[model samples]
Target: MTRVYTLVNQKGGVGKTTSAINLGAYLGVYGQRVLLVDLDPQANATSCLGIDKRSVRTGMYEVLIGAAPASPHILHNPRYKLSLLPSSPALAGAEVELIEVEHRETRLRDALAPVMDRYDYILIDCPPSLNILTVNGLVSALNGVLVPVQCEYLALEGLGQLTQTIQRVQKSLYRDLKLRGVILTMYDSRTRLSSDVVAEVRKYFPGQVFDSLIPRSVRLAEAPSYGQPISTYAPESHAAQAYDALAREVLVQDGIPTPAFETTR
Candidate 1:
């Protein structure tokens, strides 16, 4: 069965998109068929994979509004061994356009239904807000939600609101909806604050936090500008290695076969 998970966080710059892009890359590297859905209007995930957002005439907006089928809009990146349903800036209008559409929250879930079984994993990179777009991503998360929290001063802020939203969805929308795990990103090993944030997050989520701690690395930050994942751009970097371990942990937790972590070309 395909594991459909959404990397969601209302707070911006929490390494949410970074996590989605690299995690999907590593999952693909490990021999799993992966499709990354760039649901964010900013299209960071699309550009991170070397795609030009402006050049994309039809993107997530078209698919969500029923203007086009998702498969035709998907961009296959052979280098990364992954497929991406690229998003463009036009997706920003979808929040308003989808307001009057029936079953608006489930549009993404319905849109992805046809291609669900084609891949082993489908990862949705949601926008950084609790609007219709994020709701759609949450609704389409068949497996669960993966939250990337930064290790900073305000790391725990707004999480309570997010938790409440999840609870509301669980009660009224998808009953099976649950938090898959919390990922701590941008960890500075040299900072005492980083250690404090990790302990605090763990205490808050208990065993629901992922064991992988994404270290802050210059290579990791520079990869997106070059339009590449950390695995390919800096495969030897600490950030890349952490994401590789994260991919394995996700596979193991989901009872999928774990593949040997090999160097990416």
Candidate 2:
């Protein structure tokens, strides 16, 4: 079965694109065929994987509007051996255009159906806001949702609204939609606040938080500028190791076998 997850959080700057890119790369390293769907109009995930948004004439926007096929729009990342359905700035306008389209919410679900069987995992990097595009991403998620929450003072600020949106989607669209797990990102062990935030989130969600917490690293912040995932940009960095562990945990949770390898870190 293909495990499709939407990396989403209504709050911006929470490491959603970073987690989606690196996690998909690590999953590919662990012998899983992964396809990352860049659903955000910002196209950060597409650029992070070495694709220039300006050069991408056909992308998720075209597929969603029925102007192009999803397969032809997918670009392969040689570094991670993972495929990507790139996003462009034009996707920002899709919200208004899709409003009048029939079955707009499930457009992405229908677009991805033909390609679902081609990979073991399909990860969607959603936009920061909950709009038609984000709803499409959520509707296409077959496994569940993976939220990347930053360790900061306002960590739980907009979480209530996000949960309410998920519940509404589950009630109306996807009944099997679930909260897969919460990944704590940009954590600094040196800061006492990081620990406090983690504890509070764990207390709120209990068993839903992931064991692999992503640490704050300069390399992680730099990788996207060079259009590469942390695994390829700085494999020896702690961020790379953390994402690798996250991939293992995801596989284990899904009853999939993890590849055994000695860690260089």
User: Candidate 2 residues 1-265, lDDT tens each?
Assistant: 8999999999999999999999999999988899999999999999887788999999999999999989988888666879999999999889999989999999999999999999999999999999999899899889899999999998999999999999999999999899999999999999999999999999989999999999999999999899889998999999999999998889888989775633432
Q: Compare the candidates by TM-score and give the number of the best one.
A: 2
For each candidate, the alpha-carbon lDDT, in order, equals 0.92, 0.92
TM-score, per-candidate, Cα-based: 0.97, 0.97
Give a tens-digit lDDT track for model 1, residues 178-218: 89999999999999999999999999999999999999889
RMSD (CA, Å), candidate 1 to true, equals: 2.1
lDDT at position 150, candidate 2: 98
In candidate 1, which residue ranges exceed 4 Å CA deviation? 259-265
Give Cα distance to truth, residue 171, candidate 2, Å.
Answer: 1.2
Residue-pair clashes per prediction, in order, are: 0, 0
Colliding pairs, model 1: none
Candidate 2 error regions (>4 Å):
261-265
Worst lDDT run of 10 residues, candidate 2, spans 256-265
RMSD of each: 2.1, 1.4
